[model samples]
Target: MFRGLGPEIEHRGEIVVIGLGRFGSSLSRTLVDMGHEVMGVDLDSANVQAHAGVLTHVAEADTTNEQVLRQLGVAEATTVAVCIGADIEASVLTAVALSDLGVPNIWAKAMTEPHGRILSRVGAHNVVFPEAEMGQRVAHLITGGVLEYVALDEDFVLAEMTAPASLVGVPLGESNLRRDHRVTIVCHKPDSGRFTHTDRDTVLSPQDLIVIAGRRKDVDSFGPSRR
Candidate 1:
């Protein structure tokens, strides 16, 4: 339940998303699903109303106006995401407006390096090039998403990885990894980053981020090098 789509409303640690475009709309919905109360605003009335149930607050306002921002309780929000696409000026203005409102954490979407720099100057706490960042992460595991990455320590290391096709149908104990490969399957993550190493009955999914521990070299060679 929310009131006053206008700016001067009071707020707690709510997440406010500006610009109900494709990416922004999706993120707003996801935050709602995660049990967070989200406030989504856009210049278009249709866009704001379309995502009514998914957000705790929805408004159609001209984000460039400081009064509009003030009424939305931007100063009280814990975080704000500015997602205006194609309009670099609008994005920067909104970022400045939110920061000026005293919102501590401001996240702005950048279309280019220059846009990111401008966002920084305007006081956005974080600037994200969503597509570029995701592309770089995806490129890390081009070979069918086997192991994500490995962290090495003195005697043991933590391997943040996913199950290779080689281990898809294989059970944890059957690997004989501790004896042969000298590695231990520390944890298994499944669907949505929720994990349970004790649930041995649960089959492994390609989506899992299994945490394995062992000597650095052994962890690499112990399993198939590439998925």
Candidate 2:
């Protein structure tokens, strides 16, 4: 029934989003915009009505019920995200149902450490704390020359930062970044060009924007201010 929503829908598998709260709704809409066929499920009738026509499909159903989820073809979805952060019981139950159905990827929103652990044990492939992650990103942006920060794990991150003065004209092989700060420069963008992968002989320019990956502490130690 859902065809022609976007060209990307033709190639990508359907995505099932449970819980029509702010996070779930936003995720569904963004995925739709990206050309994926998204089915949004929620227990609230009002929420389903509110998102009608905005997503590929909107159903008011209790996702904790495995039968209801199956009726909506959730098992066929390539990925399912349980975005019920407030109700721990409901979130856990929904995640369990998805897992029991052998959903390939189950991403759940967790509110606390214990909650995340429970979700992981119950079959959630990925547990994310949106608020906590956003706070860390904001802290990084305000602290140094960091333009963007993407957390790859609890300790490691991929960060984009302005080239420090000390690095200008220094060859990548001679910079000793791995030895001095324990960070690796993955790529760089010159003053007026697209990003390019770095090589050992690549020299840093004052106006370059570099992307680095390492432990959070090591990345902070290699900040532009430290030069």
Candidate 2 ranges beyond 4 A from true positions: 1-12
The estimated TM-scores of all candidates read 0.63, 0.88
Worst 10-residue lDDT window, candidate 2? 1-10
In model 1, where do residues sit more than 4 Å from their true spots?
1-12, 140-142, 145-227
Candidate 1, after superposition: displacement of residue 102 in Å?
1.3
Which predicted model would earn the best lDDT? 2
Best by TM-score: 2
Each model's lDDT comes to 0.74, 0.85
Residue 43 of model 1 has an lDDT of 93
User: In candidate 1, which residue pairs get closer than 3 Å at backbone N, Cα or C atoms, i.e. clash?
Assistant: 7-70, 7-71, 7-72, 8-71, 8-72, 9-71
**Candidate 1 residues 1-227, lDDT tens each?**
00111244233568999999998998999988988899999998999989887799999999988898898787778778899998888999998888788887778888887888888888887777776555543554574444454333224555567676655666766655577778777778786877667334445667666777787578657546635
RMSD of 1: 8.9
Model 2, span 27-51: residue lDDT tens: 9999999998888899999999999
Model 1: weakest 10-residue lDDT segment is 1-10
